[model samples]
Target: MPEANIADRFDLTNWKTESLRMTAFLSPGSPIPQQNWWEEICGSPPEVRSSQPRTGVQQDEGLFGDGNTQGRLILAVQPSRIDWLLTVEVVPTSFELPSVGSFSESANSFAQLMNRWLDVSPNLQRIAFGANLLLPFEDVEQAYQSLPAYFPLNKLDLKNAQDFNYRINRPRNVDYDISDLKINRLSTWSVMTFTAFQFTNVGSYTYSSAPLNVAIRLELDINTSIDFSGELSKDELPKMFAQLVEYAKEIALKGDIL
Candidate 1:
């Protein structure tokens, strides 16, 4: 309900989400996914490869769905654990980032996928969910005023400020049936502009019509506060994601991680 409350404030009537990701840290010695899993899970064949350790990228990746309804899903296999970071934006080119259907939609989608992955590799060390929400300003000035008075900006003059960014990270606990879980909540807000290349057909060629979009962005990264020594089952990931979504809405609206 707190997330729904955003439209009522922030001088914005609607909100959009983009680049939503759910991450699962697979436990050590877990089974790596076979090729068939990639085909079945990704909806189509995936671009997977061996670990390029020389490149120094900790997580070797397997990517899926590049276009805008399918979104993006990445398998970042690290030395300690494999991270499943995914989103649902697979479609045509757009001027701006597309919504992940809704805040709750992403939670369900990610949970379902994680559930299936668990069948192949059943142990999880940690879970994380991240999302970027966009709320447009009727006038840019409204954004500055919307900044909470509690922010440590008393000394800095904001009257002439244009581009602004503020972020805070806090630890929070979610009530759980098994045990109350501790997690870290990281929230960041910024006023930003987006630019895209637009083209129109002119005979056999295309003409450029560069377009720009501006809005307020809220980024959330909530994950288990600490890794577990023992393995966690798949049953808890959905609940974890659900709680993460709730906390995200609260922190976004409250403007602080209280």
Candidate 2:
């Protein structure tokens, strides 16, 4: 399919993406070698970083940047689960019309990089892949108002809430065990809290600032897991991802669910 065809489907405007991640889960006891894997695949050493507390995985992460492609690769070891993960994140240069081709090419390159790494560590088993698309709106109220035009609201109780926020989580195909395909509305708000100190015998109250022009976020996370015992090929990886992107667009344009 032509790149412009995919780009036009979203009717994208000025927007920001947190990151686009593609991950592979290795079977237990299959550890990556301590050699120069990044240097061999990326032609340079990756910038190292630490894991966050929320991730629950205490491991150093290797990050590589491709200036030519404007993409990044993150490789991290999950000690808790005995798995290794490889993630690729790419930022769009032109917000007016983001190029899906660039993202696809980057994903294909990442798959090739993984294939090279697998050459040395052949014991690794099982592979699961997924992507996330985050679209932000400048006026969340207006964005919410426009949802009815796309989704069929007959099954949805729109009057239940004044400021509408809804979510749908369902499997795309049961036989493949593919899941986490969702369409939802998200918002940002503030909260007030009070704190008390025992030693000082004093109490204090605080309130967060009201959110400004931050846009309402619409997130779609699609995932699929497969057993490693089956055939693994990089040729079809990009095609599968493209299909997922198209599926997401179809949902936004013609899905019946709210």
Question: Which one wins on TM-score?
Answer: 1
Candidate of highest lDDT: 1
Clashing pairs in 2: none
For each candidate in the order shown, give its overall lDDT on alpha carbons: 0.60, 0.40
Off by over 4 Å in 1: 1-13, 28-36, 42-44, 47-70, 87-93, 97-104, 147-159, 177-180, 197-211
Query: Candidate 2's residue-wise lDDT over 5-112, tens digit each?
Result: 222334432223333444444545555444455567667756775555565444434654443333345655553232333343434322232222233344444455
TM-score for each prediction?
A: 0.68, 0.49
The 10-residue segment with the lowest total lDDT in model 1: 1-10
Clashes of 1: 9
After TM-score superposition, what is the CA distance of residue 29 in candidate 1 from its true location, in Å? 4.7
Tell me how far the alpha carbon of residue 111 in candidate 1 is from the true structure, in angstroms, after superposition: 3.5
